[model samples]
Target: MSNPPVCRRCGEPVVASAEQYEVFERMHYVCFHYEFEHQGDPDVECPAGGCPAAGITLPSLLFRTEGLDLAQAGNTVVPAILALEKLGFAVEHHDDGFAATARGSRFVAEDPVALLGLIKLVETRRPWRATDAEIDDALGRYDL
Candidate 1:
């Protein structure tokens, strides 16, 4: 048999059906999102429909959690950290602050829609009080 189609952007096998290959222009979803949709400053919220940074005031929160100093991050830091932990994107380390979970880092790097969903949940709900079931439901809406 012939080889599978390759991603134009990353030069890897597309690993999709013929229809999906055509639809995605022979690129992985992540590569397409990065090459076409994710542009300009990474810290700036992406305007693409499912981008986590969309309309958020603190997009940098997604990337710079480790060793974060509450004193430097200001009052919202606590809420943001709480929200991230509630979403399973971050884990608290007591006196050391928070670190991104493996899943969270993968989402930040590859899945804009999932990232958007997490941010939306934190923005709309009180993460400090949100139940695990509620968080699961919110993420489910994004098919994560």
Candidate 2:
């Protein structure tokens, strides 16, 4: 008579046939696994040869500029700049060089290694696993 329960982690419906988990309450199996094993920790290393936080890391963003030498070749920077803009991250082209906006700088302040782990979680298409609130908390921890 009751509707099927929604997964607290990802806001999706929890079907009976699929695997499930309980961590204080019901959640998708994969969501629970990722949270239990990897959430809230920043010491985790990035996967080898991959970008940190889905290539959102400061160095990785900088790499885009460096790889193309955006300053010397201004037009080529458009794509990378557009990508960041689309993602809601702030970027600006200046007389001196390209730089992340304040919000962007704040994002990069988080440890790159930890971000790599978070990025890996997001790349799996499990959006609930790596939320903006969670990311802000992770980035804030560096101050302590």
Candidate 3:
């Protein structure tokens, strides 16, 4: 068997440019990407041309796609936030909105799940924001 050879969204010719591409089953599309697992290069941009998914690093993709953002920190926060946003959680800052960091923003765009998650987590654990450990524990309790 061989890979299907075009952009499912635009019907454009797909190139073997990135290390891999993702299959957006909901959208019935296969998008090219530069993820770490199947990634070939870090410097190359995704071939989709202005695709939001292209902005996410491979780790982010895996994090969100796998639903693993319950408890995290550092670089994980960004991806976890992105994952939540992708899931329709409605993100916004405490005062602003669900925009990823400048670099993350470029990719995460208007995802709100992260913000929603943050708010919910804050409310549930008031007087104590979550640490990676707490999050992991909570996620585990829920079987994530």
- Pick by lDDT: which candidate is best? 1
Q: Clashing pairs in model 1?
A: 52-116
Measured by TM-score, the strongest candidate is 1
Ranking by TM-score: 1, 2, 3
What is the TM-score (0 to 1) of candidate 3? Answer: 0.21
Off by over 4 Å in 3: 1-71, 95-144
lDDT of each: 0.59, 0.49, 0.47
RMSD of each predicted structure: 17.0, 14.3, 14.0
Summarize candidate 1's per-residue lDDT along 47-86 as a digit string, tens digits.
Answer: 5765645445554544445476544335555565565667
- Candidate 2 Cα deviation (angstroms), residue 26: 14
Ranked by lDDT from best down, the candidates are 1, 2, 3
Candidate 2, 107: how far from true, in Å?
Answer: 9.7
Clashes of 3: 10
Q: In every candidate, how many clashes are there?
A: 1, 0, 10
TM-score of each candidate structure, all chains considered together? 0.33, 0.25, 0.21
Off by over 4 Å in 1: 16-19, 42-45, 52-144
